[model samples]
Target: MKNISRSTALFERAKQFIPGGVNSPVRAFKAVGGNPLFIKKAKGAYLYDEDGNEYVDLINSWGPMILGHAYPAVEEAVREALSCSPSFGAPTAREVEMAELICSMIPSVEKVRMVNSGTEATMSAIRVARGFTGRDKIIKMEGCYHGHGDSFLISAGSGALTFGYPDSPGVTKGTALDTLTVPFNDLNAVELLVEKNAGQIAALILEPVVGNMGCVPPAEGYLEGLRKICSKSGIVLIFDEVMTGFRLSQGGAQQLYNVKPDLTTLGKIIGGGLPVGAYGGKREIMDSVSPAGPIYQAGTLSGNPMAMAAGLAMLKHLKDNPGIYDALNGTANFIIQGLQKQISKYRLSCSINHVGSMFTLFFTDKKVIDFASAKTSDTVLFGKYFQAMLSRGVYLAPSQYEALFLSAAIDKTIADRIIQASNESLEEITK
Candidate 1:
């Protein structure tokens, strides 16, 4: 068995300083029931824990390492940039180049502004939408996390079938009132909310491909319906592509689904695993932000040299190799197929939702198209399966609510090992 003595001790020490001994809540492994693995380093497709045990990484640093950990080009770019120092409150040519590249890749974003994280991007986008539309209320899908922004933390309430209730303690009732929450893949609920709020709704935001509620994909007509509704209702549509940005395709979910929104929030792959985010869209909407217009959004480290250099290198690589998406999808499909065979052999009531390089295996027979169905998954069984996989040299997301992100570092050998590990884990958990 892998020795976790060091990791356990580290966690105990972290608890004295950091909340729950983790910077992020899920990393606490509360749902999976164990001391979280404290990774010391990562390379290619694997992570080495502080305990000196190795694991085939499935999280991929929460969907950033598309080209995989320690990518030569990105690493080189960051190293070269380090000699110039880290931050500059003023603008740089790299930021201009990065902005230009993003505009060229995502046509919907005629203009772009860099931020430090996805939460900042989403929050700023919502504020921009409200300022531009002269409306206060916004629509967001249930269980779709746009980060911990106060407005985005609202959940669905009993009234109007779309009324929102504050999910967190700090969120005010007034903030919840301005934010309407509806079920995913349910156009009717969105339509109802828009109709009820009529002319008051400023924007409708969602993950075109949700990863927060475990890789739940949009229904056949869902995106199209949303597009039509927003167009007809004069609501600015925002696609939060933090997870789906580069993972789905070159232009993100907007290009993959061919559904353009008025605004888009992006993170992950763009930073090459660094803290970076961007929100951009129609020229008119973007012009509403800062120096150019009235709405104010600014960041001192928004386009830091190191982050821009790293992101530019990563995006350039991905752009140069359009085939990466195909390869990623093929690998994800292979793993999915293998897992499915194991699921069948075990006679387990499980459901898998996969898209491109992102996937989630839910311990539920019901299809998890929305939060309601996703909640039906057996958490107890999944916890056991998670531990089983971990014990056998595989590392998955600590929470069932998160999706497993595959990296390009995974080769045929790594893929086979992951599948074999899954097979053993399924059998052991079921038995």
Candidate 2:
């Protein structure tokens, strides 16, 4: 077995200080039955753990390292920005440039606001929607995570789902009352909610292509149907594209699916793997934010120069080479196809939900189109598969509810290796 002694030691040391031995709940590997591997460094498509073991990274920093870790352009940009100073706590030319680039690329965003993380972006977006519409209630899809904001904890996904506390305790009963939820891809449910809530609902937010619930794509015409519903009901349509933005397409899932949302929250690739996020939409709606309107939201490090520089470099590269999307999707398809062959060969009860470069190998025969269906997965078997894959140098997301992201750095040879690892891992786990 690959030595994970160092990781074990680190976890032991960390638990005395950090909560649950990791900064993030999912990183504790509680669901997968092991201590987490502390990453030493990452480059291209591989992660080197503290144990001196190498892994073909399938998580890609949870969907940020699209061009792969430590990419030359992103690194160069950050280095140059670092020399100037890390933070000014004031606006800079880079932030303006970043905003212009985002507005230009994303079809719905005529104006934008930068934040430190996806949670901040989503929280701010919802507030802005409420202010603009003069309404109190909002609708979120079940299992579609919009960060750790108090209003979004009900029926949430991602780490919340993995920990078996979708409705987090800290969230007030009042917050829960305002947040309405329905299963994803169910248009009729959404319509019914809209009718019942009527003018009280301010926004309808969702992940146009959900990465939280293992990469579930929208049902055919689902986006269009929601768009129609929101427009008719005078409810703000917010697409929490924090995971799908830039990764799925130049304009994100909205552009890919040919539907536009009033507000879009973005993170991950836009920050070039750094901790940054943004929310934006139509000019009138964005004008409702502070300094222009009344709704207040501020952050000292909202547009840190380093983040802006790194994001600008990453976004510019993507804009210039649009073919990267095609390459990433192609690689993902190859890997998924190989895994499917293994499932067939072993007669494994597994199903995969894929969109663009994000996917999940669910340990279930049932199609995973919604949270309830996703839960039908055999978590115990997934834990075994995860351990098996880790042993074979293929690092997957520790939680069964999480999706695996592919990067441009993974070539055909690496893809073949991952497939081979999956085949061996499956055999070993089943035995």
Candidate 3:
């Protein structure tokens, strides 16, 4: 159970080269108070750490592994693509194939342009929005993570929001001025922002379901209200479905909520565990980018062959098998219900929020509606629970602000194990 020795050794080596011994900030374990586990390999529902400790993984690479780690078809597709080539700055047939599949599957996406990460996808989308509408200001939802770009880095989520510093160091005050942020699921704040900005606002982008604040869904009529307001004022509505896109459903949160966005940003599952991102929606809006239009955005690895092939394989499999969602939802419900039962029985002062395959257990009694409410959760209590769960061979997102993703690879047995671990962990931590 002790991985401290291997993790410490790796951390020492990594800190010398990699900043904070991790590429991503959340992996630093500052909030959880332990060395982050160095995952050697993952398969199906389990992750094997450097010290050979296996655990039921709930993070699922932050919502990408719907079919679980190293899915056979996706892995095979990537391997086959590797035989040909990895990247080509020019066009590839696989990119077209991938785009076609994505557009067909995602209801709102008519013309998807590939990018290297969610940051690029969102950044490009915002640029396109400004170019198409001829406006400078954009509005984003508080506690909603779009990406790491300068514009999105303002009032961001995940690491930035978790640490209570939405405005990052390098992001200038001018960049922050162009981006206005309001609370999640707050339609009034959105309405006021739109009315106040009027013609100056180019677009309003948000996670349809606030995943960064631990899976807080939009209130009833919230998205519909935004849609109406945006349409009325000539403001573009962008759905930052980078986390919920393929994970929520084949058509993503847009289809799930029955709200079509002007622009949509997608990542994670599309890459089939590789690094890839895409932004697409109305052809008119997308046509404003690159050679076809004025705004230019390019990447050497934008449509990498391997990423395309893996994504194609993953999307094709999901499209072919419609039952994947049902299975994933059922598994997620099982875990959430189990955790709720334990919470009720033990009378724990916590709240659980779930949507499809994503869920979070917050250490608070208030309804986690927005960033303000989500902040009420006791971080010290969450840290205790996180450590206990880790000790019980269960892997969770290190930060309480992050969502726990469940994949289809997690069977009944794995779900049961997680539930049992939660019950035990709660008891141990609360005691």
Candidate 4:
């Protein structure tokens, strides 16, 4: 077995100080039945753990690191920005340039507001939607995670689902009541909800291409249908692209799917692995934000220079080289195809849902188009498979519910390595 002595010791010590021995619930490896590997550093497509073991990184910082960890351009940008300062807590030319770039890239975003994280972006977007529309309730998809925000905790996914608490305890009943949920890709359910709560719902928010519940893509006309429903009902349409933005394409899922949302909440690749987020959309809706209008949202480090520098470099690179998306998609297809061969060979009851570079290998044969279908996966078997993969130097997301992300750094050789590991892992787990 590979040595994980340092990681095990660190986790034991961490439990005394950190909640559940991790800053994030999923990082504790509770779902996968092993101690988490504490990463010492990552470069390219590999992670070096504190135990000095090496792993082929498949999560890519949970969707950032699209160009891979410590990319030279992003590193240089941060280094240059660090020479000036980290945070000014005031206006900077970088923020303006960032906003302009976002607006130019995302046709729907005429203006944008910077924030510190995806949660902050989603929370602020919903507030702006509510204020602009003069309504109380909002609609979210079941198992679609917006963040840790109170309203978003109801029927959330990701870490919340891994912990078996979709509706978190700390969230108030009022917040729960205001957040209506519908199954993803079910236009009929959404239509019924809109009809039943006509004029009460202010916004309808979802991931255009969901990454939370294992990379489920929208059904035919699903996005267009939702767009029509919201436009007809006068409810704001918000696309939470925290995981898909830039990683899927230069302009995000919206651009890839040919659909536009009134408001878009972006993080992950937007920050280039840094703590940053942004919410932007229609000029009229964005104008409702403070200093220009009434709805109030502020962050002291909204546009941290370090984050802005890193993000700007990353975005510019993506924008200039549009072929990155094609390369990413091709690489992902190759890996998924290889895994499928192994699954068929082993006769494992498994299915993989994929879009662009994000994918999930579910331990169920049932189609994973939504939360309910995603849950049909056998968690116990997945745990075994996960450990098997880890032992072979491949690292994946620790939960059956989370998607695995691939980076540009994963070349054909790395793809072959992952495929070989998956084959061996499947054989071992089956035995």
| Per-residue C-alpha lDDT of model 4 across residues 89-136, encoded as one tens digit per residue | 889999999999988888989999999999999999999999999999
lDDT of 4: 0.93
Misplaced by over 4 Å in model 3 are none
How much lDDT does candidate 2 score?
0.94
Model 2: clashing residue pairs? none
Give one digit per residue, the lDDT tens place, for model 2 in 163-237: 899999889999999999999999999999998988999999999998897889999989999999999999999
Report residue 400 deviation for candidate 4 (angstroms): 0.5
lDDT of 4 at 258: 95
In the range 330-407, model 1's lDDT, one tens digit per residue, is 999999999999999999989899989999999999999998887788878989999999999999988788889999
- Any idea how many clashes model 2 has? 0
> Model 4 misses residue 32 by how many Å?
0.5
> By the lDDT metric, which is better: model 1 or model 4?
4
Query: What lDDT would each prediction earn against the true structure?
Result: 0.90, 0.94, 0.89, 0.93
RMSD of 4: 0.7
In Å, residue 194's CA in model 1 sits off its true spot by 0.9
The list of candidate 4 runs beyond 4 A from truth reads none
Best by lDDT: 2
Model 3 gets an lDDT of 0.89
Error of 1 at 157 (Å): 15
TM-score of each: 0.97, 0.99, 0.98, 0.99
